[model samples]
Target chain A: MEIEIERNLVMPGDVVPCPTGSMPGYGTYQNEVGEIVSNVMGYPAMYNRLVCVNSLRGCYIGETGNVVIGRISQVGNKRWKVDIGASQEAALQLSSIDLPTGEHRIRSEEDQLHMREYFNHNDLLSAEVQSKSQEGKAINLQTRSSKFGKLKNGMLVVVSPNLVARMRQHFCQLNNEVDIIFGRNGWIWVYYNNTNELEVPLIRRQQIVRISCLLKLMNKALVMISPEKIQQVFERTSDIELEDLLAESTLERIKDIDAVE
Target chain B: MTEEILFYGFRQDGRRPGELRQIKIKLGVVDNSSGSALFQIGHTSVLAFIHGPKQTKHEKESGHIHCYFNTAYFSSSGERRKFSKGDKKSNEFEANVRTMFESVVLMENNPHSDIDIHVLVLADDGSVECAAINAITLSLIHAGVPLKDFLVSCSSGFYSGMPLIDLTYSESTSFQVISEYRVAVLGKSLQIAYLNYDDIGGHKLTPEVVREITAMAIEGCKQVHFIMKQELQNACSN
Candidate 1:
C-alpha cells in the first residue's frame, strides 16, 4: 500500500485529533516512513504543520550564534570582519581576540589596527553570528570561548540555500557534531573531525550538497537524487570510507591529485 | 453555437459567473510565525504568515517596521517548483499584495520597525492575487498587528464581452480580450491599486466596462471583509 506524508508541515510526536471528518488514525503514522496509517485522508492544506520524517526532512544551514567556519575578509580599527555566509559580515572585535598580552588591553581607535597582522583577507577562520537582520543582514562574530574561532583543518561544501536552512535547524535540535556554516548566498562550510585537515572541507562540501540535494528531491520530488553518485564523492576523501565499486587505480589517481592540491 | 460559450448561465462548478467559490479559513497554523493562517478558496490553497512588527536594528534595516511579502510555489501538482526570479506576473502579484497591506497597516505606528508577510502556496487553482491579499490580511489580523481597518481585495477579469466576478481555473485561462482589476477596500474608500488589461477586441473598451468590473470586484471584497470581521469577533468573544 502507498502512503504519503504532507510537506512543510511539522507534525509532533503526539497523536493528532482527527479533523471533523477525518478517519481515526488515518492521517497518523504507525511506522518509520510516517505513512498515514489511515487510507482516508484530507487534502493537505497549506500552513498545515506536518510530522517530521527523517528521509523527507531537508538539511540545515548555519545561523546567528551558530559556530561557523568563516573566512577573514576585512579588518578595521575596532574589529575584524569574518564572512560566515550570512548576508552581513560577522565582526571579530579586538576585544573578542585572546591576544598573547597576558594582560587584557583596552580597545581604542588611536591604536594601530593593521588588517594583515591580526587577520589577513582570505584566512578561513571560525566565528558565530552576533545578530541577524532583515533582508539577510547579520553582524560579525567572535569566538570568545576556547572551542570557537578559526577552522584550521576541514573541508567546505556548497549546495542550494534551502537545504542549508533545513539542515541547520535539524542540527540545532539533534545536537550533532557536524558544524555547518551557511553562506547567506549558496555555499555551506562544515567542520567534522577538524584533525583530518584537507579532507574535511571537501567532505563537508560534497556531503552537504549531496544530502541537501537528495532531501530536496525526495521531499518535493522536484528532482531525483542519486545517493550512489553522492556516496562516490567521499571515495576521494578517504579510502576507508570508500565503496568497493571504485577501482584501486581510481583511488590511486585521486590520491595523486590530493597530494598536489 | 460559436466557441464563445456563455458561462453566465452556468459555471464549471455550476455556480454563476459572478459567484465566488467556498472559502475556508483557519488561523495560527505555524508556531514560528507571529501570526499565520491557511486559506482555501475552492481548490486553491495558500498559507500566509506574519512575523514581526517589532523593533528593527540598523542592519536589520531601520528601527521601523517594513513589510515583506514572499510567495513561493512549493508544490504544484506532482512537480516540485524551482524558485524562479519571480516572473513579471509574480512580481506584480507581490507588489499588489504589498500595496494592499500598506493601506490597512498603520506603518507610521511603528516607525523604524518592520512586519514580514510570507505566503507559501501548497496548491494553485486560480485568482492567486485575491487569495494572497485575503491571506495576508488574515495573517495580519492573526498576528494582531495594529491596523487602521481591514483591507480586503478581489479581482475581476473580462472574458469575451462578459466581465466575470472571479475567474476559475478554466475561465481564467488566457482570453483574447481580457482586463484584470485589483482593488483594495479600506473603510468607505476604494483604491484601484492595480489594473492590467489587453484590448484584443476591435473596440476602445470604455471606462464603463472598467467601472462595472471594479464594482463587482468591490462587492467581492465586501463579502470577504464581512468574513474577516466575523472571525475577529469570534476570536475576541472566545
Candidate 2:
C-alpha cells in the first residue's frame, strides 16, 4: 500500500520529511544532516519514493517534446528566433521547418536566402521543441505538422505557465463554436470555430470573449487551470453579461466558487 | 553628552540595545514585472522589481544578474537633494547589491539568461542596503527563482559600551556611535554572506568588540529570516 500525504505549502529552507530511503526531487535538496529541504516557495507532494515541490508561480521553462506558441522576434541567417516566454528564445532553423512546398528534399542555398519569406518578424506560430543545443544554451524548434503553423485571426491571452497542466490535447473547441489553442508556455489563442466565415457570428464572438475573461480571472486568482474548470466557469457566468464578468463582485464570487471545490 | 540616545538602557525608539525595528513585506505588488515586492523596515521602504531569466542579446555568457538601486529625492527627511543620472554613490551601491545577489541566486539553473533587479527607495531612515536585500529576496521568491537559501541582512552599531542592532539613520550618524557594521546571513545555515564595517567618528573597533557586534547582527538577521518566512508563506496561501 502507498502512503498518502496532504499537499502543504513550503518556503525556502523548510525541512521536509524524506523518510528512510526516500529520494528528493526537483525544488528540494538534501542537507548535511540528511534532511530534505525545499528550495522554492510552493506546495510539497510525495510520489511514492520521490518528493518534489510544485512552484506556485514563475517564468516558463521549456523542455523538449512540448508544443509552444511564440512570436517571431528576429529572423536570423538560417533560423528564426521565437520568444516562447522562456529564458531563451527557441531557434526554428531552416533545416527543421517544412517548406511551403511540403516536399521532403534536400534544401538548397536559395532556400536559406528566403527564410524571411516563410516567417516574418512578429508573426505568431505553434511549434514543437525538437532538441536542445549542444551547450544547452538555446532550444531548437520544428514546425512540420499541419497543426503546428502560423496562427491567424485569433486573440492571444498570456498567463503563468505553471497554471497550465500538461494535457493530451492543448487544442479544444467548445460546443458554442469557439476554438482555443492553449499553448503550453501560457499563451492561449481564441478564435471562431468557423474560420471560413469572414465575420464571426455575435454568439460565437461573445463566447470567445467569455473564455478570454475566464482565463484572465483564473490567472489573477493564481488558480491551476484545466479544461473542466474553464468550462464550468463559462457555464456558471452565462447568466451574467460578458463585460460584467470582470466586475469585482463577480471575481469575488468566482474565488468563493473555486475555494469550495 | 546631554542628549543621550540611550535612556534608561533603552534606545531613542524605546527598543532594547539588541532589538530590531518593525518589518513589513508585501509580494507581487507590480503587474508588469515578473516578480515584485514592497518591503519596509521601520521608516525605510524599498520597492523591488525582478525581470527575466530571459534570453540575453549577447551570447557566450552562462547567466547574468544586473541590479539597479535608486533613491528618490523626497525619500530623505531633510532638504531634497538631486542626484545625477550617473551618481557615483548610487552606482557603487547598485554594484554591491548586484554582487550580493549573484552569490545567493542560483544562476547555474538558467544558463545564457539574464536576471535584472530594480530596487527603488521610497523612504530612507537608515539601513537602506539591508532593507534592499530583504526586498530583493522576497521579489526573487515571488518570481519563483531557485536559490540555495534566503539571504537576510541586518545592521548593528557599537556605542556607549553597548551593541545596538538594526540602527536607524539618526543612530548610525550620531556621534555617540563609534563603529557600525552591516551583515548578511544565509537563512538556512546562518552563514555570513557579506560583512562591512565603518568607523562613524574615527573610533576604531577592537577584535573583541567586532565579534560582539557581529553576534548581535547575526541575531537580528535570524529575526528577519523568521519574518520573511512567515510573509512568504502568507503570500503563497493567498
Candidate 3:
C-alpha cells in the first residue's frame, strides 16, 4: 500500500486540518468546535487517520521495554531510585535484579542489608523499564538478564533523547577495539574491555574521541541518529585531525553532510 | 491636559486610538534555561524563563505552577532604588500572573510536577503586565509545555471620551484618563482569563464606557496573538 505523507509546520493555537474520524495524538487538542488544534510549535505528521506533532526540543519521555542507563540517586529499604533524565526518577526494586551468585532464591532482610554492596549511590547501571505507575508518575525498572547490570570503566556522554533511535542491538563493539552502549535515553557509554587487558592502545583512544565528537555534532544538528549514519560519518572524517574534528569549520562540514542526506 | 492627551485623533505616540506598539519576540534567548524568551513591546521589554515539569518536592497536587515577577532597580522611572523581596506591588503582580497561567496550561497532564516561571522586566515604558504576559506565553511555548491556547494580554484606557488601545505608561497614568484596565484572553477560544482595573477608585465608569474599553482591550489582545503565532511558527520552521 502506498501511504501519502503530509507534513506541515504548525504553532500553538493554530487550527489543524483533520478529516472526520481522524484522531488527534500528542501535541494536539480538540477545541469545543471539534477542530483539532496544535498545542506546540512543531511539525505536524499524519499517519493514516492519526495526526501527531513532533516538537523541536523536549525532555525525554520514557516508555516500557526500552533499555536505559541511569545513575542510582537513593537506596531505600527495598527499592533504589535511578535518575534516567526523565521527569521522575525510576524505581529499581531489590526483587527485580539477580544476585551475583546466580541464585533464584527469594529476597530476604539479609539481602536488603547487603544492597549497598551490589549498588551504591551514584553507581551507573543499565536496565529495561518493566512498568509504569497508574498515574504515569513513576517507572519500575528490572535488570534480570546478564546484559543489564552495573557499568564499570566507561565514559558517559549525554545528549537529547530525540537523537537516539530505538533499535534491537544498542550495544556494539567497534573494529577499533572500543565498546559502545547507546542508551535509548541518549546517554552513551564508551569504554575499553579492561577485563582482557589493562593497557588500551593510543589509536583506540583516538577513535573513541572521534566517535564521541561525531555524535555531539549530529545531535547539535538535530539529525536522526542511526548506526549506519554514525559509521558513515566516521569513515568520511578519517582524514581530519582528531583535535580539529570539533572546530567550527569541521562542524559546519558535518552539518552540510547531514543536510545532504 | 485633554488637548495634549488626544491630538487630532492620535495619541501622544502618534498612534491611532486602536493602534498597538510594535511587538518583537525571540525564543531561546537564555541557553541555560529549559526555555526562555525576550519580548519587546515598543520600548517596554521583559525576559521570561521556564524551568521544570520535573518532580515537585512539597506539593502533592498533580501539577503546580510558581511564578516570580522582578523589576531591575533601573527599570523604573527616575533614580535607581533598592528593591526588597517583600515588596507588596511586585508580590501582587507575581501572584496574579501565576494564577492566570495556571488556568490556561494543561496541568492535569503532568501529574506530580511543577513548572516555574521567572519574569524580569528589563525596561518599563508602559503596560508592564501586558508585556510580562506575552513574554511568559512565548517562554512556555519554547519549553514545549502543552497548553489549551495562547494567552495574550493588553492594556487600554478611556481618555477624552474615547477608548485608547495599548496605552503607554504615560497615557495610562495621565490624570485626564477616566479609567485604565488590563485584560488577558485565550486566543483560540477568546475566553477572558484575567481582567483588572489599574485605578478604579478615582472615577466611576459608566456601563457603556466600561464595555467599550473592554472591547478595545480584547482587540489589542487579538493583535498580539497574531504576532505571537507568527513568531512561534518562524521559530519552528528554521
lDDT of 3 by residue, B146-230 (tens): 8778999999999768898887777776777864698999997778999888673387888998899999999999999999888
Tens digit of lDDT per residue, candidate 1, span B1-238?
A: 1234255477567767677788888877886666788878888778888767543445335443334444455644435567634667667666766665665565643444567778777677767667777787777766645454456777676655576776555555544435445666753344554555533234456788777788888888878777765664454332
Winner on DockQ between 1 and 3 is 3
Which TM-score value belongs to model 1? Answer: 0.45
Positional deviation of A29 in candidate 2, in angstroms? 3.7
Count of backbone collisions in candidate 1: 38
Candidate order by decreasing lDDT: 2, 3, 1
lDDT of each: 0.52, 0.83, 0.82
List candidate 1 segments past 4 Å from native. A1-261, B1-8, B59-81, B159-161, B174-177, B191-204, B235-238
- Candidate 3 stretches with Cα past 4 Å from truth are A1-6, A45-51, A173-178, A196-214, A231-251, A259-261, B1-9, B58-61, B178-180, B200-203
lDDT of 2 by residue, A1-261 (tens): 345455667787788655778788877887788888888888777788988877777777677888889999999888899999888888898888888889988778999888888899999998998888765647889998877888876688899897787888888877647788888899888887566788877877777788888899888876667777887777777788876888877676567546411
User: Each candidate's chain B TM-score?
Assistant: 0.82, 0.95, 0.94
Evaluated on CA atoms against the true complex, candidate 1 attains a DockQ of 0.04
Alpha-carbon shift of residue A131 in model 3 (angstroms): 2.0
Kindly list the per-residue Cα lDDT of model 2 for residues B69-153, writing each as its tens digit: 8888789865688862358767876788778888877787677889999989899888888898899999999998877789999
Better of 2 and 3 by TM-score: 2
